[model samples]
Target: MISHFVNRKRELERLEREWKNVPSFVVVYGRRRIGKTRLLVEFSKNKNTFFHTFFEGTKESHIKALRKELAEFFSDEIFLSLNDYYTIFRYLADKIDAKTLIVLDEFTYALKGDKELASKLQRAWDHHLSKKPVMLVVSGSLIGMMRDEVLSYSSPLYGRRTAGFMLRPLGLFDSLELFENFEYGIRTYMLLGGIPSYLIVASKYRSIKELLKWEFLTPEGFFYDEPYILLSQELRELKLYFSILSAIAVGKTRISEIGNHIGVEARKLYPYLENLIRLGFVKREVPVIGKKNKGVYKLNDPMLLTWFSMIYPHKTEIETGVIDIENLRDELKKVMALRFEEVAKEFLVEINKRERLPFKFERIGRWWRKGEEIDLIALNEKERKALFVEVKWKDLNEREAKRILRDLELKAELVGLNGWEKFYGLVAKKVDDKKELSEEGFSVWDLADFKRFISLRGEV
Candidate 1:
């Protein structure tokens, strides 16, 4: 079942209203399955429009397709004989005395053979359609191309666009619409992320585990090549990127450690890491509360992380139908547990960006020194203060959490906050509700408090 389109009304309204303004060209782009088409469809449902998706076709082939669309809308004799897109756009600009919405999906593909296509469109807009009553949307999936060709500083359309949209995957709240329960579903979402196309194939009818199996195990399943499809466009060294991403997914966060596992020099990995960061799939961050140079990196796309950690290593098992679900369960569950706390951090940080925090920190990250290690550090960069947070998904028991906290505090003391402020913090699967926090003199942010922090602060 499709979850109700619960958010992004503002984005929708902005696109809907674009026709009222001059220079109404919008560039909407994102990674595959991120609902770019859906958002447009949602807007298109309320308008009169020309919508065309460009893919896997030669320029002549695309022109022919455009001709067919024009022929059907106007007539073969009137419009099909036209060869140039500029002329067609020029002519159509006059057809509508009122608002018209034109969606050119996968616009990069349309411009692939003709690097001058953006320039051509600009000429058409300036010479003819500039005075027309229309809103034009150019959408694409290749982020590098979209940014360089359409949105780049040197491109002809650089300053011509009235609005820009890079649609993102659905969030934690959106997942609630997809699942009946919170706990089990969060884990599933941690595996698949918020890609709409994946959600289309994920079992809305079955248990979460069953859906995951269908997504990853069954040879003919829709998402069998989903991760590969998404990664191929953005990364050239698939194996190395896979190894590094898998290592991170399975729970190593440090650069040196990830390099060690991937058998690459840390210096060699920088370009790949930077590309992933730009693609919005991975992140490099320093402690929100600690030293600026001491930083860690993690996979930002939950599905990619989950795919590399669990799916890639288990591909052979799925191929032979020899996969033991129970055996797979034990191994994947272990990986999941290791990665779960990191997911908790993302869930926390995503929420915390929305508002003022009790800690009032400027940054949040994992921290390590030549000797000491800490799970999380949130620094109030302005105040020069820091909060040390340790997450426990394994030992929710009070004594176990307390032991972790004690070690975390010791670790924090070893690495002085570079003459900044001081605060010790602990986070867990379930903070010991019975443990009197103010009495203990240690500030504790339990799961509820962490979730509250996110809810109150997460602006985007």
Candidate 2:
């Protein structure tokens, strides 16, 4: 079991603030295994709390389970016999004498089992629970259902919530705490993208190859079927979505290219792509300094990216136990390279947060026009200053580093920020003469900078 609670200070502070106010309704939600339950549990300590986890079952069974939990918490036999939501709320309102917390975790299962469950809870809250000194929290992992049934405008409980937020995965800095050092941390982050449970499993392994073999390559591996489960939870048309993800994973990024790869017309893919985007699976990216219509899709979820890129395409060979880890090393390196660019961007953003960079950039993203591409561009539109950065996944000596930076200066001209205060930089795994590059007014960083920044930030 993963016993350590890594970092959710902001979330805990938010919950604690709400705890001070009486009659607060809070909604917490996210993708499964993203630590929603654990956060709630951590927040619920040493209070008059009643926490119940609803499973997939009929409405009657759900009520029975809730009643049993409530009866145990309150040490009152009355709750055990109350079989309906409204009546139960009424009884709690009548019997309670002090402030209390009622947490409904996996509450979507109840909503799934009973279509009228939200309305019933709404009615209960309006008539009885809302006036009491109680804080009601409902959380679930079904993102679509949670939004529609709780957070959406059409939902009965929409305007009633005092606060609501979708808990996202940890950032690279925070996630580094789970690993031994920067190499293991960055490599694991490239594959898992800061999910706590997955990182816990990953922290147990010594090398990337061993981790992949034990947890991903075989049919019985923990993550072998994970993407399928996640997709099936929030989406229909699984086969089509899988195809789209796989297509994007292998570098078919344009809408037309993905359609061609999946044997579907480009126009017909918008809805599926939109749904994926809405659910946080895929993201559409356009050049930071280009036309709005020039968007290309990429898998936003890192686990899915790893799955489709490294596992899904080679499933047949993997299942037959004939696949060699060495054979996939090159492809894995490519995936890691792409992911490293994202990490580099994240590092720059963190640096910008503390004004460690030359100027505060308002926005940053990849920039490309035709065949030429810059790995990253940070823009301060108001100041008209721009930073062009090239990210590499390889080690470069002083001569090679200067060559890449000179080429970056050339590409900077094509960006059309001629009058803007343009700056050039590089980020890579290793750079031989960072001090020299820095002295030349270039922003250069390698893994050493990553470790230094992380160490200064806090424990890791």
Candidate 3:
């Protein structure tokens, strides 16, 4: 199995810092399969830890399971018979004289099993666990439940946490560690979007085509029904949400477009779209230099994007055992091309971090008005400077590269940044004579630069 623990140094360091501060209540939450439990397990190494995972069962069952685990850890027969949360916390507060880590993974499961679990934990922490030199870490996979029951201001545990953060999926640079070939790594990233568990499974396959056939195209495949399962876990009105996602995945970006496609009124989609945005499944974007109210929605999760684009459209044939790889090739390429723009943006962000860009951009995003659009625009508003770029998923010779750059400049002029220091650039899969283009004062980059950057960072 691929190591899912490769790129969590920063998260580990944060946990270490929290460990140094006793009586810490740390809340770590994210979507399912984003590796919250793995991160906590890594942090618990060599420490005095009592780790227990809660399940979807009765409150008494949850208490009994935790008590059993604690009974073994503390070697105290009394804990085995303990029937309540308060007494457990009271016992820990009294027994844990030294620094200790107490991790409650999937705490939301227990919370759902008992509606008053959060309030009960709040009472336990306030009356018993607060004075102890313990770091109590609780993590959950259900984003909406976690926020409502633990992190929201209306929650009983509000203002009680010492630290909290949503664990995000791995970025491009860190995700490259999973594959030997840079090109394949990019493709896998486009398909899976850096979720560690998914990347681990993807890494085991020889090629994307093979991986898709066995893991995605077949009904018995691991990912064939993944999106359905994921949606069912955290959402009600499954059909509407599925239709909304399907619409966005197929390029119905505007609220009007999505609503029309899904056969709902535009205004009614706001709540559903907001929920998806909050759950990290969909994202809304406005032009970097345009009216804020003019926003468009897109599928934020790469897996869902791939599923809706490639699998959902061909679901009938696949379910009937007709797996046509060749027929799906063009669709996959289209998805890759769309995702390559995002990859290009990520590359520029990394470069900006190292101060390698012409000037440090305060914001970066796609820019458009009317029909003319730029693939990316990096702006340093304080300095009144903008960098406009056109991204392509093709191998471009010098002439083609210059033509793109020229078109980019023309588009930049239409953006109405007349007084701003405007610079033009091009990014592509491959660009011949990149050095010559760079010498001509264009910010040029290709796959070679990406490879070099990964190698230099020692991530390969």
Q: lDDT (CA) for every model shown?
A: 0.73, 0.90, 0.90
Instruction: Write one digit per residue (lDDT tens) for candidate 2, span 1-460.
Output: 2348888999999998889997899999999899999999999999988889998899899999888888887789989878888788788777777999889999999998888888888988888898899988999999999999899999988789998899999999888888875688789998889889889888888788988999999899889999988889899899999999999999999999999999999999999999999899999999999898998898998888888988998999999999967868877998899899999999999999878889999999999898899999999999999999999999999999999999999999998987899999999999998899999989999999999998678633
Stretches of candidate 2 off by over 4 Å are: 1-3
Off by over 4 Å in 1: 13-17, 73-77, 203-208, 235-240, 243-269, 289-297, 329-331, 346-357, 383-385, 418-424, 432-435, 438-460
Q: Residue 160 error for model 1, in Å?
A: 1.7
The C-alpha TM-scores of every prediction are 0.85, 0.98, 0.97
Number of clashes in every candidate structure?
Answer: 14, 0, 0
Residue 60 in candidate 2, Cα distance off native in Å: 2.5
- lDDT by residue for model 3 (214-283), tens: 9999998889999988888899999999999999988899999998998999999999999999999999
Q: On residues 139-204, what C-alpha lDDT tens digit does candidate 1 reach at each position?
A: 999898898899999998888888998888877656545665555556666567777666655636
Worst 10 residues of 3 by lDDT: 451-460
